[model samples]
Target: MSWKTVLNEIKSSDGVLEVVDARCPNEFRSKRLEELFNEWEKPFWIIINKVDIVPKAFADRSKKFLKENSDAVDVVHVSSKKFYGFWILRRSLKSYFRDNKAKLVVVGFPNVGKSSLINMLAQCTVVSTAPVPGHTKGKQWIRISSKLLLSDTPGVIPKEFASRDWAKILFPDDVEESAFILLEKIKNAEGSNFEELYGFSPEPSEETLERIALKFRFLKKGGEPDTNRAATKLLNDWNNCKLTAWWL
Candidate 1:
């Protein structure tokens, strides 16, 4: 998202609730958004979402790292899907708006559960969900009650979002490259069995994908393995938390 769009959302909100993926802390955070919160003097609360996919220690360490790096108003770790740690965030918001109604703008990178959290808070599917990044478009100002309001906008991309950075929001053709990046991240992370997961060593080329195709029996006509199918499957598994050795 452009800075102007984010600015508009901030202008309309009383506070900011930023959601981030707990599995990949470094990749999900946006310094630009945090700077905006500080510049506007708005309370900045971070929700380290998808904590259920990773270990508890990952969230704890990530909370510490983020708190030390940024002057956020508060940081809470939770899983939006299963509603873990949702109570803490709910209580915090309720307390903040006890005497006055509060309107908060939800911001985050794509695929970080911004819409899902809104649904959880409203106890209904107020916003739609798409697994593909950059799928959410437009905005809505939802009224939960007299005490609170929520403004949901499209996920914001960080200033550092570019070729050098991992593509959080990917096009269809970008899936293979994104999957390769995801594999490398797991390979470099502590205690990850990236090689063992696919039953083959990692390589910059199609070696990992070829192995995956053979392992999963993803084949083309005449029994030739389909690497594209394998690649997509691997990516889907990683995204859905079916394939993750370690995360922090």
Candidate 2:
């Protein structure tokens, strides 16, 4: 769906839930979206999804940081895979809306587990979910409870992200360059375990891709390390949550 459509949906909703990846909460957040929510005068909350992979301390710190820095009413950390923090989220919503029913819109960048969270909350699969970016092609309104409704939208990037490297890294035209950028981010993040996850420490260089290619037996003609294939695999792993990293 287009950003204009998403904005229209948001305008129709009573509140907004901005789902973000717990592994890199700050990087995934959209300041422009927050500004829009504020301008619309809708209740806004930050849902930090995928807390199953990151440390609890990291999740807490992330929540605290967002609460301090953003305009969100509250920040909640949750693990959709492990079914954690659902009650708290529900309670927060209930307290805010009181006796009146509310229609909320869930928004976020691609592959941040919005659909999965919705499924977990509704206790069934109401929307399709996939590991890749832009898997949610359209919108669906789901009733999580008698008083609460949710609108699921396709992952969207705001206009401000057009110039950012991280945004380009999300839907990259060049996979190898994007992989290199992701590798550098992971290498620099605190508490990232490159060796534990991939069996070797990366050096933020093309040689790292070569090593990963050889290690995973991704080869091309004449037995050369297939850097493109290796980069694709690395990006896949990152998107699929097979690899985990967090920055503060």
Candidate 3:
């Protein structure tokens, strides 16, 4: 779906839930969306999804940071897979609006678990889900409660990211380059366990890719390390949530 369609959905809803990955909430959260919410005079809550993957302390700190840094009505940490934090989320919305009926729209970048959160909220698979980005292709309204409705929108990046490397990394044309970018972020991010995840420290360099290739025995016909294949594996691990990192 287009940004114009997403904006229309936001304008029509009573509020918005900006879902983000708890592992790296800061990187995933969109300031442009928040600004748009503010401009529209719409109340928004930041839903930090996949909190099960991060330490409670980290999640708490992230929530605190977002609460202090953004204009969201509330910052909620949740694990849609574990069905965690939905009670608080529901209560927060009802408490804020002081009504039994509400219409909330869920919005976020690709692969941040927007669809999964809606499924958990609705207590079933109301929309298709996959680990890949852009799994949700359109908008759908789901009745999550007797008087509450939630609209699930296709994930979108801000228009400002049109020329950014992170945007390119999302639907990358070069897997090796994308892996390198992700590796650099992980290397610099707090609480990253390079040795624990890969059995060796990472340098965010070509040599690191070679090491990953050799360790995984991803070799070419001439027995050379297949860095491209190694890069693919690294990206797969990231998308599968096998790799973990968080930033304060």
Candidate 4:
């Protein structure tokens, strides 16, 4: 679903005190999910999952951004892989729902640990988690506590040019716009060096994009770089910040 649809649902839910974002640190920025949360007139918390997988640099930057944009918003870092920080997140939820008896919706992209975070919060395997994309295909509600109910929704890609808009939101007011652009450009330019550094030497004459796929081992059944599959793999990895330390 789009963030707009999610917001509309929250608005009509009759007093959801907090909106929880259960996305990886990089996705919270790349998809501009945090900006959507900050725009919310209602109180909310950012519950970032898969903390274990994200680099420390990204986590620190994300925390700083969360601290600055909205006082009502707090960032919660948790790793389902390591099962850490759920207690702190629960405390935040308890505080948000205190005396309000309101619902908290957990939203994020697919496979960003939304289901796992919800299951962990509910203290049961109430939600399903899988390694493949589009696992949580529908919405489910789980009660986190007596005063709080959490609604989990499937992941979505924004309909209109999500990537560029998201990049703008993520780098807002930093006064380093050109620097960010340059860095991204440099990363793409150094793709081959990265492959070699990782102990792989792809043919330079081959398609550069295909080289990326081959370097990452996203091969076809015929042991070739399936360009379509490579694109999908790269896009997913880029979204999840598996490409580089400063991937987001």
Tell me the whole-model lDDT of each prediction, alpha carbons only. 0.70, 0.81, 0.80, 0.51
- In the range 72-123, model 1's lDDT, one tens digit per residue, is 7678877778867766876777776686878788887766778777776656
In terms of lDDT, the poorest run of 10 residues in model 2 is 124-133
- In model 4, residue pairs whose N, Cα or C atoms come closer than 3 Å (at least 3 residues apart or on different chains), thus clashing, are none
lDDT tens digits, residues 1-248, model 2? 68888888789789999999999898788888888888999989999999989988988899999999998889998888888878889889888898899888788877888878877776643433323234345435566555777765544656356436666566777889989888888888877657886788867788988999999999998999999988898888888888888996
For model 4, the superposed segments whose C-alpha errors exceed 4 Å read 1-5, 14-40, 109-112, 123-140, 154-157, 164-207, 210-229, 236-244
Candidate 3 lDDT, 86-136, residue by residue in tens = 888877887887855777888888878887888788675343332323434
TM-score of each: 0.80, 0.88, 0.88, 0.59
Off by over 4 Å in 3: 124-140, 158-163
Superposition TM-score, candidate 3 onto the true structure: 0.88
RMSD (Å) per prediction: 5.7, 5.1, 5.0, 8.9
Descending-lDDT candidate ranking: 2, 3, 1, 4
By lDDT, who's the top model here?
A: 2
Q: Which candidate, 1 or 2, would have the higher TM-score against the true structure?
A: 2
Instruction: Looking at model 1, report the run of 10 residues with the lowest lDDT sum.
Output: 124-133
Question: Candidate 2 has which clashing residue pairs, if any?
Answer: none
